[model samples]
Target: MNEQLQSITGVILAGGQSRRMGRNKATLTVQQQSLLEIMLNKLRSVFQHVVLSGSQAAAYHTGLPVIDDFFPGCGPLAGIHAALKLCAGRGVFVIGCDMPLVPPELIRYICNCSNFDLVVPRVGDYLEPLCAFYHRSCLPFIEQALNQGRYKITSFFPRVRARYLTAEEISRFAPPDRAFFNINTPADWDRFCALYPDLKA
Candidate 1:
């Protein structure tokens, strides 16, 4: 791990309702390890302080510091807010739990570009807000967006200094399609399994 990355905390956002999957995606297995476990390990390898932003139940399972949304039901923005508060000045690498294949190298790359308030990947036209880096300075802008009922993650982007990782840069870490693949539904999980059958072992 780079010395700079060691100062940043890793936050796993596991607060999603999982309506499409009809089950807690955190517990879903890949290679006999839960998705939460895989993500936790990946983040742990790079960050000294790793925490989960989700329900108390998840905390019990993972045995890490868990934080609930300060603004419940407001979507991922709430999770981001709570994580920023928890870190208390340290930068955070926030990622969704369902994205089992998010390469750690990509995460390191984003963290390396931490000169901005937000360092997010711009894969093609989509901004991958979930798999991004947020500095403590972004809390106020994020709170302003939340108070105005703007729940979109990118809603506060304009108010802050943001950096977007280009598709070509992300491609060096992993293929565009596979880099941000998240398990949203049963079919998505099945597809992931088919693509990586060795995960079952």
Candidate 2:
């Protein structure tokens, strides 16, 4: 955590509707703390500043400032836009709401990656954009994509610089595939609990 705090502003994306979970995953508990609370706690240790990117006014009461997506209903891209727009620094480290096992060491490694507009890990040909870093330089491309109604998270990648983490590269920190796991459904949550026995506490 100390290593990651050197230079980064963590942005926790929690604006999703959580339809699959049938409840607000952000408020779900893991050891008594809400998922959002746990995420913010972990991020605060690594980032110089932390901001919650979402529209939930109730979250503002948590004492951290909240930033909403400039354009709503566009999925993760909206969260990315909000982070980019409200970040006090030039670069922002983004993390999703449901990824409780995100390793801080891995996050630090990605943040330290210099000279990249975006730094993302690839999980079997799929890019994990939700858990990555973005530079202010990507703002124009994001704006263009949003205006054009092309809100896919990776739509702006072709127009900007991006560093992808191969399976081998990520394996140093976690199992090539397990590293990107998260809870999206009750079944997944149950499996995660079984795998990470401590989560049930």
Candidate 3:
């Protein structure tokens, strides 16, 4: 696992068309730092290489490579496929741009596990596929799904060697509910502000 950690690359999925936020979510500031910058800092602390998977290259500002989705508008699956292909390794840690409240320890823990083709966390019944671990070997399956017009990130799970981190395990990494808070709409942002008023100040 340690050996794999040395080879694991971090991939930030930031190519979303944030219609709900009425702006680019990647550029949205949280506590004076853009979510992209926060995620990059967290990723850089543990991974050997971290790449931003999105359309805006300059917005990343991390100096790491920026990978544009090969199939635009196909959603997170396309971002996963592109990261796996562009990464200089087999396993990659993936996260979303809106997930500003991501626990850094959770990411480090994910990087510590590499035997499985994927390591995804479940928040309640919903699988947080956007923030998960994926191997390059799954690219073909993803490509196949994309070709079939299936854009769901979970569509290829049945064919892969996946390990699902239950809500119980997720709580271990992110206790008291600060692990998977991803902002989708303006309401979510307002809620975050209410929850973490210091983050806004």
lDDT of candidate 2 over 10-109, digit per residue (tens): 8888878889999888887766777787778778867878888878734537787788888988878888887887776667889987887777777777
TM-score per candidate, in order? 0.94, 0.91, 0.92
Clashing pairs in 1: none
Show model 1 residue runs off by greater than 4 Å.
56-60, 199-201
Clashes of 1: 0
Kindly report which residue stretches of model 3 are placed more than 4 angstroms away from their true locations once superposed: 199-201
C-alpha-based local distance difference test score of model 2? 0.79
- Please give, for residues 1-201, the per-residue lDDT of candidate 1 as tens digits: 677697789999987888999988888987788888889888987788898896643644777888888899998999999999878545899999888777888888899899899999987779999999999999999889899999999999988999999999999988877888889999999999999766421
Instruction: For residues 20-126, write the lDDT of model 3, one tens digit per residue.
Output: 89987787776688877877787887787888887865465667789988888888898888888888876789998777667777777766666788888876768
- How far residue 132's Cα lies from its native spot in candidate 3, in Å, is 0.3
> Candidate 2 clashing pairs?
none
- Which sections of candidate 2 miss by over 4 Å? 1-7, 199-201
- The RMSD of every model to the true structure, in order and in angstroms, is 1.9, 2.3, 2.2
Q: Rate the local accuracy (lDDT) of all candidates.
A: 0.86, 0.79, 0.79
Best by TM-score: 1
